[model samples]
Structure formats: C-alpha cells, structure tokens
Target: MKIVIIGSGNVSYHLAKAFQQNNIPVSQIFGRNESDLKFISDQLQIPFSTSKLNDADLYLICVSDGSVGEVSRLITKENCLVAHTSGSLPKEILAGNYRKASFYPLQTFSKSKNLDYKEIPFFVESEGEEDLELLKNIALKISKKVMVSTYEKRKYIHLTAVFACNFVNHLYARAKEISDSQEIPFDYFLPLIKETTQKIEILEPKLAQTGPAIRNDERVLKAHEELITDQEQLKIYKIMNESIKKMYEL
Candidate 1:
C-alpha cells in the first residue's frame, strides 16, 4: 500500500527511516519546512514537498499535538485513512472527512539515536475493525508489540510514559547538576543508573527501591537537604522523600 508521512520532526524522521528499513514504500513526505523535509527525503530517498500533499492509501500525521487538527484539515483526500502519531491525542482530533485514526508509537524518538523498532510498542485506535486491522498489520511489521487501545486507555499510557521516561530523564539532569557543583564527573553515576534500570526489569520497583528516602533516614535526608542550596532542587528533593515515605508507610 502507498503511504505518506507528514511532519519533519524527530518522529517523522524516525518513522520514515523505520519504514525504509522495513522495505515499506512511502510515496512521499509532506511538511511545511523545506530544509527539514529535504533532510529526511534526501536520507530516505523519498519524494517530499513543502506545498504539495501526496495522494496515498495511508497518511500518517507526525506533527505536534497542537498542529494535528490543523494539519489534518490540510489533507483533501476523502474516504482515505488519516492517522496521527500522537500518544495523548484522540482520533477525533483530526478534523476532516477522511477516516480518522491514531497510530501512536509509545517511545521517545530522537533523530541521532538509533533504536530497535521491533522493541517499541505501537498503540493503535480506529473507528472500524478493518482500519484497525490494517494499522495493526503495518505496526506489526516494525514492532513485535502492538495493541488496540481506546482513547481512555491511551491517555493513561501517555501519563505513565511521562513518569517513566520524561520525569526520569529530568531527574538525571538534576543529578548531573548536583555532581557538577561538587566537581564530580556525571559519568560516575552511569553504572548506578544502569543497574537501577536493570534491577527493575527483574524486581518490582517497590522491592528494588533503595536510598535514604525509602529507608526513612531523616538524618541523611536532612543532611542532603541542607547541602542543596537551590530552593527548587531542595523542594523537589523534599517532595520525593515525602512521597517515598508515604508509599512505603515509613
């Protein structure tokens, strides 16, 4: 089936690359940014246009959440399947006469980072069984895990991703800030971070939990709190500690 990818951001680039690697032919890529679209088109050897929207069997909208509705309206292709790659947004957000669907890949995409697409989970939502199966088949080509999720379920999935991926990355940044202030190399924490993630794979996170917070060591917590000069950092540290304490009923 002919496919067209929309947008020029990381998601668009990665999705295009994944499709190319899997021998899926993308008829064209449509986007407003010429330079960015050119980069993806040149790399993937696919035709692209800043002004022209290609007619295809499938159109995957990879634009930002706020732009999904506006971008979907741009597609004049009626009775064709139009899907958006957004985790939080529903299929109804795409305002058009075409068949609206969600083809969300549940992972962080970075143009510079190479990922095993087979390991990523794709969550698809559609209004009909036929379209849902079509999306599921396409997703299964590149990923081992694909699920049919409702909008309500997808909402919680996105929220859980924020806690697991986004918030965890932010904490790593905060950790680096503390290490930098003390003239300690941030690399020193890599092994610990790796082990922490590895441990969670085998053990429940609660059972694998460590640190003064879980132990409810007020002495150590107070000492660390005093060392943090930044009020924002201190606030986060205290809130985390209190959260841990409450979770474990310490």
Candidate 2:
C-alpha cells in the first residue's frame, strides 16, 4: 500500500519511519516548508517531498487542527480512503464525508526518541466498514495496540493526556527550577518521576499519590507553599494539593 503523509512534523516523521521500518510503502511525505518539512525530509529520507498534496493509496494528514481542512483539500479526492492522525479532529473532516477514519496514536512523541509503535495504542475510526477494517489491518502492521475509537472518546483521551503527561511535565519543569535555585541537581527527581509513573501502571493513581497533598498535614502544606516563591508554582501546589485532598476525602 502506497501511503502519503501530510504535514511532516513529529507525527509525520515517526509514522513515516515506522512504516518504512516495517517495509510498508510510504509513497510521499508532504508538509508546509513554512513549518518543519525539510527537517523531516532530512531525517526520514522520504523520496517525495512537496508543499502541495498529491495522490496515494492512503492519505494520512498530520497537520495541526486549524490547518487540517485546508491541507486535506489539497490532496486528490480519488484516494477513496483517508485518515487523520489527530486526537481532537472529527472523523468526517476528510473522506469528502465518505470513507474517512482517525488514525490517531495516543502517545506523546518527541523527535529524538526511537518509538516502538507496538507499545503505543493506535486509535482508529473509519467512515465505512471496509475503510475501518483497512485502517485496522494497516495499523496492525506496526502496532499491537489498536482501538476502534469514536471522536468524543479520542477528544476526552486527548484532554486526559494533557493532564496526565503534559501537565505532569510542566510540574517537573517547575520542580527542576526550584531545585536549581537551591543548588540541587534536577536529576534527583528523575527516579521519583519514573517510580510515580510505574505506580500508576501497577495501582490506582490516587492510591499511588504521595506528597503533602495526601497527608492532609496542614502545617506541612503551608511550609512547602512558603518555600515555593513563584506564584505559578504556588498555584500549582495549591490546586494539586486540593485535588489530592479531595480524592483522598481529606
């Protein structure tokens, strides 16, 4: 199957590489040079690169939310089967309201990491029965984890990812800053972070939760807050602590 990728960013690059690694044909990779097209081309060594969309068996548009409709229109309408690797986009946005599906991968991607698709859950949707099966089969070539997901479920999962991964990363960044200011190595938190994530896999998050939040020791919470001079960190601490307390029924 000849695949064409639209918007050569993180998702595009990774998907292209994963396909090629599995010996699946990626006919072309398209992107706006106004963004990160060339960089992806250089990394993936994708033979065909174009700012304008072209023809392929499967069109996987990985462009940003606002640009999805605009970029998708640039592709040939005859492909009959198309999918977007977006969590928040509605499935019907493409396929000319025909056979479209969401080929969303529910994992945070960084350009530097060598991703193993087999571990990442692929969320798929298709406009018709045939298209759904086609996407699922294609997805299985690279990933063992696949889910036939709805638009609303994908959106909720995206938001959950924001809170679980993105927000946690920001918290770590803040922790690093506070540690740096105190001449403590930010690396000290790495094990703690890893352990916290591991605990969630083995147990419920609320049960795994640590820190002053769960203790309900008002004095300890106050003392920690005083040390966090930054208003943002203070606010984060307060909100998170409140959440933890509520979860624990404190």
Candidate 3:
C-alpha cells in the first residue's frame, strides 16, 4: 500500500525508514521544513513536498501532539485512511470526511538511535472495524506486539511512560553529572542500569527494590543527600527516598 508520511521529526523519520526498510511503498513525505524533509527524502529516495501532498492508500501523521488535528485538516483525501502516531490524542481528533485511526507506537523514538521495530508495541484505534483491521494488518508488518486500545487507556500508558522512560532518563543524566564531577566514567553505571531494567523483566519493581531507602538506612540516606550538592538533585533524592520508604513501608 502506498503511504504518505507527514512531519519531519523523530517519529516521522523513524517511521519512514522502517516502512521503506520493510519494502512498504512510501509515496511521498510532507513537511514545512524543506531541509529536514529533503534529508529524509534523499535517504529514502522518495519525493517530498512542502506544499503539495500525494494521494496514497494511507497517510500517517507523525507531527507533534498539538499539531495532529491541524495536520489532519490539511489532508484533503476523503477515500484514504489517515492515522496519527500520538500516544495521548484520541482517534476522534482526526474526525473528518475520511477514515481515521490512531497508530501509536509505545516506545521512545530518536532519529539518531536505531530501534528494532519488531520489539516495539503498537496501540491502535480506528473509527470502524474495517479500518481498525486494516491498521492492525499494517501494524503487524512492523511490530510483533499490537494492542487495540482506547484513548483513555492510551493516555494512562503515556503518563506511565513519562515516569518510566522520560523521568528515568533524567535521573540517568543526573547520575552522569555526579560521576563526571568525580572524574569517573559514566559508563560505570551502565551495568547497574541494565541490571535494574532486566530485574523488572521478571520481577515486580517493588519486589526488586534495594538500597538505603528500602532498607530504611536513614544515616546512609542523609549522607547521600549531603553528598549531592546540586540542589535539584538533592531535592529529587529526598523525594525519591521518601517515596521508596513509603512504598516498602519502611
């Protein structure tokens, strides 16, 4: 099926590449930024446009959440199926005279980082059964895991992802800062990070909990708080300490 991808950000870039890698026909890409669009177009060897859009069987809008509705309004094709890769936005946001769906991939995307699409879970919703099945078929082509999720459920998933992925990454940045301040390589924590993630694969997070907070070692927690000179890091440490303490009823 011929597909037209809109936007030039990380999600759009990765989706375009994944589709082309799987030999899916990507008719054209549309974006306001010519340079970014040209870069992707050249990489995929597909024609791109700043103002014009080509007719295709599917249109995947990968623009920012705030712009999904606005971008959907620009697609004039009434017969083609349109979908957006937004985790929180409802399928109704693409309400128009055409078939619409939500084709959200439940994973963080970065243009510079290559991802295995088969490992990414996709959450899909559609206006009709036929369109939903069509979306599932497409999703199955790229992802091994696909779920039919409601907008409400997807919003919760997005919220939890902010905690699990985004917030956790910020903590890693803070860890790197602390390591760098001591002239230590940040890679020292790589194995710790990997082990922490792996533990949750087979165990509940609470069951896998360890460290001073879980052990209720107030002296150690206090020492850690004092060691963290960064005010923000100190605050975060105290807050997490309290949270972990409460979680384990320490």
Candidate 4:
C-alpha cells in the first residue's frame, strides 16, 4: 500500500521508523515544517514535501490532538483511507470525505528512544470491516497486540494512561525537586523507582502499595510532611497520603 504519513513530530518519526523496520514502505511524509520533515526523510530515506502532498492508499495523520481535524482537512485525496494516530481522538475527528479511521499506538513516543514495536499495543477503529481489517493487518505486522476498540473505549484508555504515565512522571519530577532541595542525589531513588514498577508486573498496584501512607504510620507521615517546606510539594504529599489512607481505609 502507498502510505503517506502526516506530521513531523515524535509519533510521525516513530511510526515511519516502525514501518521501515517491518519492511513496509511509507511513500511520503507530509507536514508544514520542512526542517523536521527533512530530518525524518534523511533518517528514514522516505521522500517528503512541505507544500505538495502525494496521493496514496493510506494517509496516517500523526499530528497533535488539536491539529488532527485541521490537518485531516488538508488531505484532498478521495477513494483512499485516512487514519489518525491519537489515543484520545475518535475516527470521526477526521473531517475528510474519505474513509475515516484511527490507528492509535498505545505507547509514549520519543524520536530518540528506540522501542520494540512488537511490544506496543495498537488500537484500531474503522468505518468498515475491509478498512478495519486493513489497519489491523498492518498493525499485526509490527505489533503482537492489536485490538479493535471503539472511540468510547479508546478515550477511557487514554484517560487511564494519563494517570499511569503522565501523572506518575510528574510525581517523579516533584520527588526530584524535593531531593534537590536537600542536595540529595536523585539517582539514589532509581532502584526504588525501578523496584516499584517491577513489582507491578507480578502484583496488583493496590496490593503492592507501600509507604508511610499505606501503612498509616502517623509519626513517619508527620515527620515527612514537616520536612517538606515547599508548599506545593507539601500539598501534594498530604493529598497523596490522604488518598492512600482512604484507599486502604486507614
């Protein structure tokens, strides 16, 4: 299939790389930024254009959530399939007359980070069985896990991801801030963080939960809270502890 990938961001670069690795040729990369597109083109050896877009069997819109609709309207091609790679967006978000679909890869993407595409889960949705099967087949080539999920389910999946990945990472940043305040090496917490995540592989998060809050150790919690002079960090610490206490009925 002749494939044209839209956008030049992390998702775009990673999708193009995944396709190249699986021997699926992406016909072209289309975007507004010439430099970013050129970088992808140079790295993946795929032809790209800033002004002109090529007609292809499939157009994968890899732009941001806000830009998905605006970018989808740019594809003037008819009798082709157009899919966006957004976990939070529905296939209906694409405003074109063509077959609308979504080819969401459920993983955080970074251009510099190499990932095992086979380990990534792809959630695909389409208007018809033919198009849906087309997307599923493509996804199956690069990933071991591919599921047909509706927008209703996909949105919830995205929301859960925010809690699991984004919010958790933000907490890590806040923890680093606290460590830096005391001149404590943030790297010292690496093993703790790693073990915390690794434990989830074999244990339910609720059951695997640990810490002063989980234990409801008032003395330790009070001492830690007193040490956190930063109001924002203190607030977070208190809120998290309260939440943990409520969860465990402590």
Best by lDDT: 4
Against the true structure, candidate 3 reaches a TM-score of 0.96
- Per-residue lDDT of candidate 2, residues 71-119 (tens digit): 7667657646778888899977763633577899988888888887898
Put down candidate 4 lDDT per residue, 1-250, tens digits, no spaces. Answer: 7999999999999999999999999999999999999999999999999988898999999999999999999988789999999988989889989999999999998888999999999999999999999999999999999999999999999999999999999999999998898899999999999999999999999999888888779999999988888899888999999999999888
Candidate 1 structure quality by residue, lDDT tens digits, 124-240: 999899999999999998999999999999999999999999999999999899999999999999999999999999999999989999877889999998899988889899899
- Candidate 3, pairs of clashing residues: none
Per-model lDDT = 0.93, 0.81, 0.90, 0.94
Query: Which predicted model would earn the best TM-score?
Result: 1
Ranking by lDDT: 4, 1, 3, 2
lDDT string, candidate 3, 1-250, tens digits:
7889999988998888888888787989999999999999988898999998888889999999999998999888788899999988988899567888899998898877999999999999988999899888888888899999999999999999999999999999998999999999998889999999999999999899989998899899988878889999898998998999888777
Per-model C-alpha RMSD: 0.8, 1.7, 1.2, 0.9
Q: What is the lDDT, from 0 to 100, of the residue 195 in candidate 4?
A: 96
Q: What TM-score, over all chains together, does every model reach?
A: 0.98, 0.94, 0.96, 0.98
Candidate 1 Cα deviation (angstroms), residue 156: 0.3
